[model samples]
Target: MGRKSWFWGILLCGLIIGSAASGKASDFRGNRWGGSMKQVAQQERAELEFRDDQSLFYRTRVAGLNCYLIYQFDRNQLYQAGYIIPPRNRNLNGCFQDYQKLLRYLVADYGEPQENQALWSDNALRDQPEKYGMAVSLGHLARQAIWYTPGTVIRLRLWGENRQINLGAGFFRRTQEETHPHSKTVFFGI
Candidate 1:
């Protein structure tokens, strides 16, 4: 091939590779969760103390879309929130049940004192007949008595409007232990 053809070939190949990478990134961007992790963090007040006996970490990724996941234990509280980056929808039914069970166990272990009453109250988990702003949406599929895991009760909270501002939590334990406390306190949308 002539020198000019060689240069063109290299440039075309570079363009193709770049376009493919960009396309793959774009796919994640489209599925991006909407909302700000910061906002979600700021909105949630810690309902319980985090026990430090277990391992946990906060993970974030920004490809075409921005996402955050809190890997506490084996499960991940993942969030893809913010403006239209793509893939803006997240249905976490499985995770939701996990949290429901955890919360129930926590309430049982700690006893539903006034402070913890809301977490255990049927009205808080399941929507009340009045259907007001604070009414939580607990699906019917996971309703059961409390069952503890990790030899300790852990309560997690997840929140978002179409993947914006997802929340996670660890419940207060009777046994005191040092733990790394982390939370998303603010999120900005561009």
Candidate 2:
């Protein structure tokens, strides 16, 4: 009985390990759901900083023709972030007041389409600054606000992961008065 139990335990452990071993590497992409439908979650942006002087930046992304929402906040030279997605996008907008409900929630806010190139931008001097750190992948998202002296530099990132492929997207934000440099980086999977 002891030997049998040990064998069973070993089998279970092997099965678990085998399943995990099939997952994609950090930069590797893969197919999912037997090719019926593939999905990738958003990723987080890489760590970045500002230059000697720069300010106020913005960026955006869409989910393969779908929109994503982002919320940004500033406090005493510090920056914060929030996210929202609308119910309509979640297939839950069935009620007569769905629009109103969505407006209230902003859980899945529809923003712009996904960025095709490695970088994106809203300000002229910087479009996903090349010197700043940035990383975004499917299924997750991250942002950084660098407070250099009295100015503010904001970095935004979004990523998602599914059985199929990995995806990453991001942008940056800075204020006009702020004088901090910015950096940029890219992910390859998505």
Candidate 3:
């Protein structure tokens, strides 16, 4: 091989590697997607909430709301991260407002949602038991949104049922093998 050809070949390889590494998606707080949980905790100053064999839970705040950041790993590689907002205040409107606020914040960072939906139906209200009158009203006011990138997917949802408001943000790898392509695990009613 000629000297000039060798130089260009090496330069092209370096450019390919550099671009690939930089193009991966970041977690909600800007941590690298495939990095270790320890690195994430150190970088984000997150406190340990819980830990088991397969996942780690960290306490953090998003948009001034308490959030539990769950990190799911497969063979030591962080493949999924979830931002869970626990039920608070027992006010359906307040929960909806917080969900909207968080959605806007996510949009600012991740751009507009690819899928935004607000669903309501008389049947949804009717399906609930008579004892859950207020909850039926709240359940009729559900909203959900999703954003996608080549390397990650973000989902936001707000729904109320059984007198409890549920909301969350989920970030997941685009091609993880062990879990669903959408999210590591689904969270419902909490």
List TM-score per model, in order: 0.24, 0.18, 0.70
Clashing pairs in 3: none
State the lDDT of candidate 3 residue by residue for 1-190, as single tens digits: 6533432332232110000012545544667766776776666668876666556776788878897776665566676666667656654446656887899888987789988986665454445444233543356656678777776667776665546566777666655424444232233221
Predicted candidate 2 versus true structure: per-residue lDDT over 143-175, tens digit per residue: 221122112222222222331111122222223
**Of the candidates numbered 1 and 2, which has the greater lDDT value?**
1
Leading candidate by TM-score: 3
Candidate 1 local lDDT, 1-190, one digit each (tens): 6533432232232110000011122211222122233433444342222212222122333222233322122122223221111123344443344445445544554454222222324445254434321233332222222212332223333332322322333322212122212222212111
**Per TM-score, what order, best first?**
3, 1, 2
Model 1 residue 103 CA deviation in Å: 1.1
Error of 1 at 72 (Å): 12
Error of 1 at 108 (Å): 3.1
* Global lDDT of model 3: 0.59
Q: Candidate 1: deviation at residue 98, Å? A: 3.2
